[model samples]
Target: MSLKITDECINCDVCEPECPNGAISQGPDIYVIDPNMCTECVGHYDTPQCMEVCPVDCIITGVEESREVLEERYRIISGQKVA
Candidate 1:
């Protein structure tokens, strides 16, 4: 599942750089994660980088999407399907 930044986000811009997929971006009030681009660090890190760096614990995993769903989502975002 993709992670999301809650209202608790302090707009400190800390989490933006932690995302490996470049899914995190500065939003109107807080950081935003593009679910399409987010693999929850599945192929990059041991865990969600944004959640690890968030100072206020504002980042949380969204509804748990299955690995199949996640892989498909990643494929769509990356424009390549896995074999």
Candidate 2:
């Protein structure tokens, strides 16, 4: 599942730089995570960096997806051909 920034986000500006896939961005009100680019750090790290650094714990999991799907996304984002 892709992570989402909820309204509880304080806009602390920490999560943006922490996202390895550059999926998180400043939205009109709070930070928003691009589902297309979000792999939850599947291929990059053991855990989502943005969620790790978010002080307010506003980042929440989005639509349910299997680990295989997330892994495929990570590979595509990393420019690796799916095997």
Candidate 3:
């Protein structure tokens, strides 16, 4: 599943730089995670860096997706041939 920044986000600007896939960005009111680019850090790290660094714990899993789906997204995002 992809992660999402909730309204509880304090806009502390901590999560943006932490996203390995460059999925997180500043929205009109809060930080938003691009689901198309979000792979839950599957290809980049053991865990989602943004969630780890968010002080307010506002980052939460959004759309429900399987690990295989996330891995495919990671491959596509990283320019790897998807199997």
Instruction: Report, for all candidates in order, the number of backbone clashes.
Output: 0, 0, 0
TM-score list, all predictions = 0.83, 0.95, 0.95
Q: Given candidate 2, what's the lDDT at residue 54?
A: 91
lDDT: which is higher, 1 or 3?
3
- Taking all chains together, the TM-score of candidate 2 against the true structure is 0.95
User: Which of candidates 1 and 3 is the stronger one according to TM-score?
Assistant: 3
Work out how many backbone clashes candidate 2 has. Answer: 0
lDDT of 3 by residue, 1-77 (tens): 47888999999999999898899889999999999999989988998899899999999998878889999999999
TM-score, cand. 1 vs. native: 0.83
Task: State which candidate, 1 or 2, has the greater lDDT.
Answer: 2
Candidate 2 per-residue lDDT over residues 1-83, each given as its tens digit: 47888899999999999888999899999999999999988988998899899998999998877889999998999999998
Order of candidate numbers by lDDT, starting with the best:
3, 2, 1
Q: Which ten residues in a row have the lowest lDDT in candidate 2?
A: 1-10
Task: For model 1, state the Cα shift of residue 67 in Å.
Answer: 2.5
